[model samples]
Target: MAESDSDSGNLAQVRHVVLVLSGKGGVGKSTMTTELALALRHAGKKVGILDVDLCGPSIPRMLSVGRPEVHQCDGGWVPIYTDSEQTLALMSIGFMLENPDDAVVWRGPKKTALIGQFVTDVAWGELDVLLVDTPPGTSDEHLAVVEKLKKKHHVDGAVLITTPQAVSTGDVRREITFCKKTGIRILGIVENMSGFVCPHCSECSNIFSQGGGEELAKLTASPFLGRVPLDPQLATSLEQGQDFVRLFPHSATYSSITTITQTLLRSLEAA
Candidate 1:
């Protein structure tokens, strides 16, 4: 039997936890998570992206879901399933608050409890992969999720996301260090917004210094997942609450994300 199975019960019974993280914000990490989930679904994987960024949750908007009805189930709250019927469970603090704009002012313990409920109390059923989209910076929420999963639940690995910029790259290094301290495996690094592809000319321009993510991966000894260029069509779709993978499948942006998905599957197989 595999060591993972020997330690984690039946291999088939354990869910693959792929934590999608970024050292800072505005690097398109959440958007990458959304597209990755869609690409995995396209490739026939029962996947779900858990939006844990309480202060600024984007999964609902990415999936075009409005305020979903949440109620007690058995012992806890039930996650809202997307319209695709693929059972993509969503648990975010945005759903529980009385007002969406209200601030989530809590200390470490409260944040930890909320994260615990999100993981244990919610009915995720069975998932092939749970892509956890964490918030920017090493906050209480981020620490809570990593600690809970590492000490309690079975976390398969983590995928770091960053832009091809010096600041983001620097931040990713810290994220890798944090993972090292927590014993969570660093699966790979995704270089998002590596460049901007000009559709009319089919040319790619380095909007941000390119290859920073790959360099970080090399420095940290993690796999370089792939790079996603900045595509305006993607931005437009996102503004209108549409996902590029599902809405613009034939676009260049979608192709970039598809490549990332392929690389991700290969990493999982290698693991």
Candidate 2:
């Protein structure tokens, strides 16, 4: 086993483990993970994010903590805190790299080993939820995460991200199949970039074909969380590593995200 199956006590303090997954890249899995964690924190829940996208560890930059040193204690490596209250925490391979621009060009086995170490090594302490941001596609990294997390800490479920397009929804179907084959429950499906929200007038325009994600969810018998429109202000905030959820409470994007978060919470509660 990549991780010691007997070492299940490491994540005993973690109450829920949820994975943010996508079949294709640039579908906003990382962005969803960041925004959801922030919303959960705003709702008074202690949240942690484990960025397992070793090839592209953008969560560290997204959270605005750039390449901070990771310390270790008797339990395991200490996760970097993102806020003064310490309600939000993050751990990613980006902190270990000498340079942020460097690419992680390791083999499949190496990636799997690093993921295994991350699963059992992070001292998350007492967290209400831990959201895992996975890489695009169903590859060795995904298998490693499922194996390690299932053998040790329980995986509550997975939240699939997809764009409002046929191509994107088609790829997400594969992700749904992957979850089914691995026995990971599908919490819900989120439609991202479903429309473009004008910053000035606050009107939404469908730049891409809409309703694909919701239609797919209905077809697959999965829960349709909500749709997040593409807001320029939200994009700018993400680029600057600012908290858009707090800064832009009146934005449509914020409303959508909050709705999604509430629905997801309800699902978890009902489970």
Candidate 1 lDDT by residue in tens digits, 100-161: 77898877788788887676566566677888989987778888887666544567788899
Question: Model 1 clash tally?
Answer: 0
RMSD of each: 2.9, 2.3
Point out the worst 10-residue segment of candidate 2 by lDDT. 1-10
The candidate scoring highest on TM-score is 2
lDDT of each: 0.78, 0.92
lDDT of 2 by residue, 1-271 (tens): 1234346766878878899999999998999999999999998999999999999998888889988899999989999999988999999999999988999999999999999989889988889889999999999999999999988877889999999999999999999999999999999999999999988898999999799999999999999999999989988888899999999998889999999999888887777
TM-score of predicted structure 2: 0.97
Model 2 clash pairs? Answer: none
